[model samples]
Target chain A: MKAKIYVTLKPGVLDPQGKAVAHSLHDLGFDDVADVRQGKYLEVELTTPDKKKARADLEEMCKKLLANTVIEDYRIEIE
Target chain B: MKSAVIVYPGSNCDRDMQVALRKITGSEPLMVWHGDSDFDKVDLIAIPGGFAYGDYLRSGAIAARSPVMREVVRRANQGVFVLGVCNGFQIVAEAGLLPGALMRNRDLKFLCKDVHLRVENAKTAFTSHYAGGQVIRVPVAHFDGNYFASDDELKALEDNGQVVFRYCTGDGELTGEANVNGSMHSIAGIINKPGNVLGMMPHPERLIEDILGGRDGRALFKSLLKTFPLAA
Candidate 1:
């Protein structure tokens, strides 16, 4: 099974890197851009075929090591 | 006092901290590697600054999970004095030794300069040598030093007087320019709830010698030595 996790900064937390990217886009004539919040996308391949177990394991991985729960939220999808 | 300085793979400031403590206490500190499991009855444990684990995923994230930190945490909970500086601060926060997390600077830059800080509380073991509200200059060099905590956590820290230092202008007034990293409430350093652990982004060890610029940071070591009289 293949899994993907998206990690994003929590709401109300400042994302300087995302803001800088948004500013750079505006400076480069991309005026249509409203906002951008940078996030991390992780792709993992698991040997387990059980979707339920894979999801649970991925969430645990995200909480334990992949993401900082204080300011980050993560979602996992298995395929 | 017998002390130990934890040395991670990428730690570059362990020697500087060791030298400062040696000069003040007149004792060579143990340089403990990250793989060490025992602290060996040390009076103090210091986590020095550097890009530990190359700061690959996050600053200090990898180093916080190292074997030495497990023992450091264990000892710290038993009332051991643990000091974390710069990247060391990040490691402590990540390991839950201190409140709040250090994120990238507000300006998204690697700030490296001499910054002034006001001593908010001098009753702790780390700042007893300095008077409260006294402004001291310390050099800071880091890309991610902006401290963040929940509103309730901030209020609790303030209520308990855990805020030990805050960025301030030379005249001791808080201002945006004084806050190089845009830390919450302009916080520069803080102690844990129990007050035995302290984490700060500034490099006090780098400023302990007069040749480096100022010896203002010497007070921290002096104060710490006073806490453990036997170490002197």
Candidate 2:
């Protein structure tokens, strides 16, 4: 099984890097872009064949280490 | 005062902290490795600044879960005086020792310069040597020092008087222009509700000596010595 995780800063938290990227896009003539928020994407190869176990384990990882719940929210996709 | 400086991998400020502790308290502080589980008998524990664990998962994220931090969290809850500066502050917050999360600077830059800090709460053990509303010059060097907290949490921290320091102008005026990293409420440092744990972005150890441009940070260490005497 493989797990994919998306970690993003929570809404209302200032995303400076994203803002900078947005500015660069504008400089490149992408002026229609309103905003941009940067995030992390992780792909993990799990040995477990059980999707249920992988989902549960990924949730644990997200809460404990993969994300700082204080400022980030994470979503997990298992295949 | 008997102090212990936790040395994490890539910690650059542990030596500075040790030097400051030895000079201010006239006692050599114990150097505890990140893997060590025991803290022994110590009056103060300091987590110095650095890019711990290469700041992989997050700044101070992996280091906060290291073996030694488990003991740190336990001791901190038991009224032990714990101080975290710069990356250390990020570690403590990641470990849930303080409120709010330190995000990247508003301008996305690593700020390294002297900023004036106003003493907001001098009643705490860390700031008792300074008078309330006193402005001190200290240097801050970090990329992620923008403090952010929910509205209710911010209100609670304010109501409980946990905000110990706020960035301000030299004359002690809290203006938006004085906020270097865009920290919420211009907070440069804050203490826990019990006032035993303090986490701040500025490096007090860097400014403790007169030859180091300023001695504004010496009073902080002196204040701790007064509260936690070596004899005790």
In terms of lDDT, which candidate is strongest? 2
- Per-residue alpha-carbon lDDT of candidate 2 for residues B1-232, written as tens digits (9 for 90 to 100): 8899999998999999999999998889999999988768788999999999898878999999999998999999998899999999999999999988899998888999999999999999998999999999999999999999989989999999999999999999989889999999999999999999999999999999889998999988999999988787
lDDT of 1 by residue, A26-48 (tens): 99999999999999999999999
Task: Give the worst 10-residue stretch by lDDT in candidate 1 chain B.
Answer: B223-232
Off by over 4 Å in 2: none
* Docking quality tier of model 2: high
Could you report the DockQ of all the candidates, in the order they appear? 0.72, 0.84
User: What clash pairs does model 2 have?
Assistant: none
Q: Which lDDT values do the candidates have, in the order given?
A: 0.92, 0.93
